[model samples]
Target: MNASPKPPALTTSRAAAVWSLIGLVLLTLNLRAAITGISPVLGELRDAFGLSGVGVSVLTTLPVLSLGLFASLAPVLARRLGTEVAIAGALVLITAGILLRVVPYAPALYAGTVLAGAGIAMGNVLTPAVIKRAFPRRVGSLTGVAMMLMAVSGAVAAGLAVPLDHAGGWRLALAVWAVPSLVAALVWGPLAIRGRRAAAEPTSRPDARGGTGRADGSLLRSPLAWCVTAFMGLASLMFYVLMSWLPEIMRDAGHAPATAGMMVSIMMFVGIPLGYLVPVLAARLRDQRVVVAGIGAVMAVGLGGLLVAPSAGWVWAVTLGIGIGSAFPLAYTLLSLRSPGPSVAARLSGMAQTGGYLLAGFGPLAAGVLHSATGGWDVSLGLLLALLVPEIAFGLLAARPTYIRLGPAPLVEAKEIVVPEPARAR
Candidate 1:
């Protein structure tokens, strides 16, 4: 008998992988782009829409809240519609939201923000899983790349906000970001189609790396999972809270609008380097507590400066940039580090981000309320300074070398954790 012809599936699989890789980077670039630029133009929005302090706060907080509200749906959509298709849907929402936000009506602005945020929420939860699935052995390095890209995009969006506002107005600045999402959505079109074909084959074995996308609730029992969730939540909360209010804080301290906007841009720019360093360094070390503690120390110094000498705003912005850059990527790495397989990673990623973002969503809102009530930023900054203590405690525990156990048995030691490779084409 003649040997069987080579399986066409292998060639098809490689093509899909390469395309999906491109799609992943494009998607990652948009994750923070929609959220970062708004602060720089908050004053304009307030004047345009007649937004009070509380309303401005609500505008900032709503995207994050939408992230929490819609994050849980990501895994479900991935499981049912296929991951690629689900991601495409997310990009569609983002594009729609960005376009809608630019409309002249105030309600359109609010609606668009929520829509864009929902897309970002799904991206946040699913990006880790896709990274896990595509490059299991290289999660740390790839995750660092993704975060670095995220930082770069965020920095550009913020840095250009004022200039763009000058060129065309806040509407043009906000509207331009939609182009990336629309392009990304179109790129994913082919991938989604391929995924649909693969999913249709009735006898398909569930990809051990979470291609099935089911995040069963088994994580609820693991204390380690909760620790990671809390760490991520608090870290994310600090990041969003500060990102939203820092420019305003600078303005309150008498910086020019352009200068104040640069503060947010500077913070994001600082993240560009740390975004790569943190995860790769965290992955190399057996324990990541030092890394977490070090990031916290940077945050403390930065926040302390902001609290005491709001006059020297630039120095603190760079310092906090160092803190925020490393802080978030390290927390994100935990989602991959703490789990055994891609599917488990996806589940944990989903769970952690949902709780984390919900907690973070409140930070901006609360800060706004306190600022509005007290007529100053002192109380807001003070609360953030106080919160760091618990944040550090949780970061240490979450950074320990332990794996989330999917079964009823106890948690596994660091050595027991396995980093399996993606299945090769036969």
Candidate 2:
């Protein structure tokens, strides 16, 4: 019998490409649904699970902590399993975690959150790196589209979770989210096999910034790198903390629960358009300074309005929505823009995300703890303002046109690459 030719390694079929895109969208949608969805129902979940304030905070903290912990390891996992397998596996974990809430026990509920967070962590870190590998030519536009979908999905889940809970019980509400997670896993599974085939095909590997390698400490030591990291982290810190606490803040200002939740949804909804818009816009601009300044000013205006006039809160909410939506996409764009190429992009993305997320992990908890200690919302909001200054300063630096230089500069023309919001390693 003739020996069978060795199966081609990592060759993606045309079918795999189409399915991978679908899998990407679905996976993006799954990332925030559980946590953002839970925020709207936190009061209910706290009561149902018999959680104290710390316990309630833990519910939110566990996911972020897990995200920070696991995100650091994503590159290694992708190397071992290939991106498709890692992502597909993440979807399975996410599905299991989302369904865990249905068990009617605190341990199960928290355990589910932990597992789900780990899934999200892997997806969050790996997706951008995968995108860097998959779509080197159009990172910005693609990142924009994926992030837009991420926002839309997150908004839908957060907006509807309460209604769903009211209509069918929290167990049903939490469990129902499992449907999408499982579907994503199924969609990605075949594509993953195909993806492995594509990987096996010999293609000239791109340069270091684009190639798969662990980023050096030299890149880590650069000021530009720190700027990217701080910009991403502070932006996320604001984004996540606002998502977690904004509804409650608005409610304290006298808006009804529905209205308060809707405000948060609106903020996220606006983010979808900006997710697409910001990167596209930023890519065309020579310097991102103007974009950064504009977004920072807008955010300041929105926050100022909210602080000054609690009665006209919805207007400020809209303003905040626009500001945040715009700024967030720009932050993601910088990951690719500042990197010399794909490898650096991935490494930078990883560094920025890992560090940024560690800082961001503190946001919700800090806001909640401060609120509890001060017995008011003002102090908490004030702390956010304190943070805004550094966010803007670093954003200005990151927005400048530059890339991290490795050892000796090759005598090659520099090429610009656009990164997307969801594509940010974090």
Candidate 3:
């Protein structure tokens, strides 16, 4: 019997690659616009709709919880439709969900979020694989750049939504975001067409083995895989907590609502450039442990400032922003860096995010509950501080220059694996 033929290479001209990067940035920009945009408007919506704190928290929680389930279904959807088509369809669902808020009914509001979140979930899980497949040599750079776009869009939407809502209604503010989504869809529409054309060609069939395996039992057995999963999970938990509670945290410190919202936006703003910068730097480093520790230190300092010196809050927010911003993209970059191939990247991304965001979903809820219990943000921030310890430890493990070594190959002789001591210290 003949050995199986090697897969065809992903072919895109340098110009096409550049264009795809641009498209990726735009697509990423839309992913969180609807979600982060809503965070600023939550108070307005809650009052208008007669929602309780728990009710609003439920609204916030549902999308992230749904993301894991939606992500599980994404591979199937990608198989049924081409990947680009699935991504495009997700954008349409997001647009429809945003539009649904025009009615402002409780059911409609919640329903729209679910639909919109589904779109975000697919984009979140798939974009890394797409980036890796399309820009193999520049995974770190592209992941950083794309995540930067996400941070920028999120900050813009969070900061601007209130002003937009005041000028136009919340309905208009919510729906106006549909323009960017539509624009991204339009930009990506051509790429999808190009991909479909390419995919339909006989030459393209060689690349179509669904390269990675399913996120099945064997994946759970891998220790390195668990490290990646934990790193992704803890990082996401930190992110969602800030996104969900930062503005309120600022408000409690006595800032005006608008100012607090802007402060929250500012924290995310510092992350935008770092999102692009950190990954490029990290990729060149021998080990990412130093970077991980440095970022964690920055985060600790920023959080400590918030707890100790409420007067210098703005400065601390900027510091926190840099720390969190860099950390977020780094976490995303790890998904690709740790995977053996595009197939594995896809599978691991789905698994990591499924477990990761489920862990993340609890962060803000726990923060809110802790605040209610203790009557302050101190306990909440303290708890987050404790969580960061493990994140730093696992991030160091993940940051090391090695992919997840699978179980012994069938025909190859067994050899002792070189387990790094630093990773074990974590």
Candidate 4:
């Protein structure tokens, strides 16, 4: 007749929390390094391998596709192998993929890129779940930390890849990332083993359920979930389009090639601090719709500025960078805030990322087609501006203080439904 007592929250020791944070930072560092590192060295690769434009495009596109395709598999992996083990396994895949590229063949290079991208995809989906489970109370701050690290590492790789390639050839440039991937795996290995051993133990509570709750496939039908997906997809689409063409846009505005490249660097640099600050601010707020709308406005203003005043590009770059940098972490934090528990967070994250990144893969190609068709940057940039309409609409919806309810509730009362312990801490 009485409801079952909810399980006490698992307590992580300060030392253990620090170590876990370290592992997370190290793992986040690898997520975008592989993709960005290759971009700066495409010339070297083309020269060495006699790659055509199509081949070069494939190399650039493979990782984005992998991010979407493999993200769907992360939840299945976490359900089966446990989250910690799945993450560790993903890191190992990344390490192997990075090392494989040093083999000096096109087959090996493409294979390594896909492998690495798949590994990064798993990491991308699971990292938010891990943050939700481990630091539920501090999701905003911690998500900011992780996202900042990811952005910084990516920028560093893009900057260093050319120098590293020059120093010891492209092989060394690609292979050097393997060291950090290996370190993250080693750091996370013990945690995964401990989780597996804990899970193997018999149930401490006789009536404890193994799952957080039944996922009624409601996420597939939920309007809120779609909004989240749209926000993620559109924001990513905008970011990637700019990443691919911002320098060219700058050059077209009468700036020299070197100045255009430097402006791109400035755009990225401006994001670093805003990436850390925005999520922390968003977390402290009750509803993030205002922040979300504000970001959209800033980005719109920046784009408008770019359209009107080509010489004041630095101002537009900084404004756009802050807008986009904040947008990503905002989307990530929404995954945790809008979910009741880590399991739902993982599912939502998987859904958002799979759909989001897939949409993102189209942005650059679409922009290119539009440019070629219209014979100018105006039409392509205008198309990007139009995308902001959907981005703002969905972002506002996703920012509301509401949890995603996927299906009908079980016969058990809400209080009687026990939230499952985190798999990582099991």
Candidate 5:
């Protein structure tokens, strides 16, 4: 009797997709854990390390700086190593960095921070690309899930930092995060090997399924690219600035350290739902200008509240959380939506993150410095408000339904978009 054979390829693919989704979510969960834990215990670390104002600024700036500096290398890595392998490599960096930071050496702290942040840089740039490639039809929903998970991770890290520190000093609190990164890296190991095999196979196409084959596009030359970069940069600048200094602002306003840290957690908690919904909403829209304008307005109100009345800090935190939560996800969604293919998506993600995070690095550093000088948060908060004008303007420009002009190709659009005269040449 002949037995019917199960379709091995189909079964294997289904299994792989399930694993991909799991690995992707796990990776997103760890992205913010390493960084967000710091703000809760910033004062303790400062006192322990004898950090001066400049040292504090540098410490605060390290994450954003590493993200910016390492972002450009993402697409390059994708080009050299397979995307899966590159991401695997990123997780390795994150795990090692997390472990490194908790060592008794002083230099290990900054060095580890930079290393972890760099790994985050890679994750930030490629995560959207992976979604665009693996779940093309489900981009909106999957992105929502990923963003939601990322917010959840950040909130958890912030909320638990104090508790963890109380249980076992600051070192143990930071060291605990290494567990997630290590687990994620292990999960990625087989995926990376499988990816490499798929890339080498003659019948396999990397571009079709998260491989990093080159796509035809001169992304850097496009002005729309700059608009996307500017909007993302400014949005990130606002978010990181608040994340880095919001705790200090609250602490100085007479809130307890735990309470102040919880504000950061609250901000992230509010982000959880917004992170899920914003991408879903933005993805359904052909023109995102209204969404962009609305986010800016919300952020403005929050900042205004913070500046005028630090007494009601929780109110501002929730408000800021909604705006900040929506803004970054929107920026991330544009990276995938604006591109026609995975290759272009990865490239655009790299470009946006490199320029954007570099611009954002200045935010935390400047915020730290400004607070140090003025000895108050009003000036720093006000500057963030002023920056919103340009943020919204660029957001409007970027939200146009036009796809980035690729190489010498004429501008493409998801819908009919009239190319402005100034953008025609580029």
Candidate 6:
């Protein structure tokens, strides 16, 4: 009897690489659809569910809170399960959650939201690490591509939600989004299996960033890391607030329901091209402080415009879109740029996203509470304006050309094995 040959080592072929990129794009597309899709049909859902203002706010807040709470688990899962496998699991969770949300029960809806959000949070933290490992040389371009797709998908979901709800009611509208997650999972599963096989094979190459153990602990003490966290958190707070309430703002200003939804879409659509462009540019720059300040200025101007004259909603939408689109990718880009290597990138991403989303989760709830208390949008808008100060300040600090030093420097001896001679010289 002859011995059987071992299977060939796993390698990424050109076709396979293309498929992986496509899978990533598809995955990015699903990240926000489940969250943003609900906003357009929120009014209908409120009526159908008999929800009060706070209940409506919670509908948006719970998923975002889940994103933050679950993000820290990604690196742990990836270490235990392999990155690709973890991502596949996330997709499954997303699909299941999306399906569960349409079950016509409040508990089911919230549970589904939490499930889907947890899944998305895993993908959010790991995507940068995957890109860092797979496309080190083209991080900017690939990050741009992923961010652009994210914006495009979010825009489409927001724009189409009301119409889809009209066509088949809110349940169908929300449930139909699960199809994309299912498709992405089908596309990604084989890739994950291949990755698992490759990882199982032994290699002599040093782990990226030297070692992954306890190195991330240093980030807790690094001022730069805190700055990055603040910037990410505040930006997210602003974006999610707009996403949750922009349609309502438009409608309150006298637009029809469909038009109001489209206005939100317009804001998101304007960000798509800028999302692709901003990261590429930010990556090439020496220091991103100027760009950060510029984006902040744009957001401030747009928010002021909306507060004063929302009837010209398109103008404000375009401005706000460009500001957010540029700011978001730039923030994500900094996660990779400021880190020394992929492991550090993963840690930074996890920290930024965990803290960021946790803070962001409060934005919608606070806005709802303020509006309820004041019976107007003025106080809510004012709060957003106040947040911009910290965002811009921290963004500038985080944008500086510096890396988070993970551990203390090695000790150096001025004189070795010459104590007597050194004392004589002294």
* lDDT of model 2 at position 326: 83
Q: If both were scored by TM-score, which would come out higher, candidate 1 or candidate 5?
A: 5
Q: In candidate 3, what are the lDDT values of residues 1-426, reduced to their tens digit?
A: 989654443334656777787778778988888987887788889987999988897887888887876876665666556677777887888888888876758889999989998888888887877876776667766777788778778778877999999998789779998888888788778778887887687653211222342233355766666778898889888888987788888888888888887777788777888988887776555567788999999999988888888668789889988888887688888777776555566667777888888988988889989999999999999988898899998988777676653454211111221222322346
Candidate 2: what lDDT?
Answer: 0.78
lDDT of each: 0.85, 0.78, 0.77, 0.83, 0.84, 0.81
| Poorest lDDT segment (10 consecutive residues) of candidate 1 | 416-425
Model 5 Cα lDDT, one tens digit per residue, 1-426:
999778898899899999899889989998998988887788778877877887776777788789889998998898779789999999999988988987777688889999999999999899988887787766777788888988888878977999999999998888899898889999988889998887787883544323343466677688887888899999899888887789999999889999998898788778889888888887767799999999988998999999888879999999999999899999998888777667677888999999999998888878878888998988888899999999999999888887765768635656632222223365
Per-residue accuracy of model 4 over 360-391 as CA lDDT, tens digit each: 99889999888788877898888878889999
C-alpha RMSD between model 2 and the true structure: 5.6
lDDT-sorted candidate list, best first: 1, 5, 4, 6, 2, 3
Worst ten-residue run, lDDT, model 5?
416-425
User: For residues 200-312, could you state the per-residue lDDT of candidate 6 as single tens digits?
Assistant: 88863443334332344557877888898899999998888897798888888888998988877777788889888887777666578999999999999989988999899
The candidates, ranked best first by TM-score, are 4, 5, 1, 2, 6, 3
Residue 315 in model 2: shift from native, Å? Answer: 2.2
Model 3 segments beyond 4 Å from truth? Answer: 1-19, 47-53, 193-217, 247-262, 405-426
Stretches off by above 4 angstroms in model 5 are 1-6, 42-53, 203-214, 247-263, 308-312, 368-379, 415-426
Candidate 1, residues 14-117, lDDT tens digits: the string is 87778878998999999988988787899999999998887886897787889888888887788888888888999999999999998888999999999999
Better of 3 and 6 by TM-score: 6
Residue 368 miss distance in model 6 (angstroms) = 3.5
Judged by TM-score relative to the true structure, which candidate is superior, 1 or 3? 1
- Candidate 2 Cα outliers beyond 4 Å, as residue runs: 1-16, 198-203, 207-219, 251-258, 372-375, 405-426
Q: Cα RMSD (Å) between model 3 and the true structure? A: 6.9
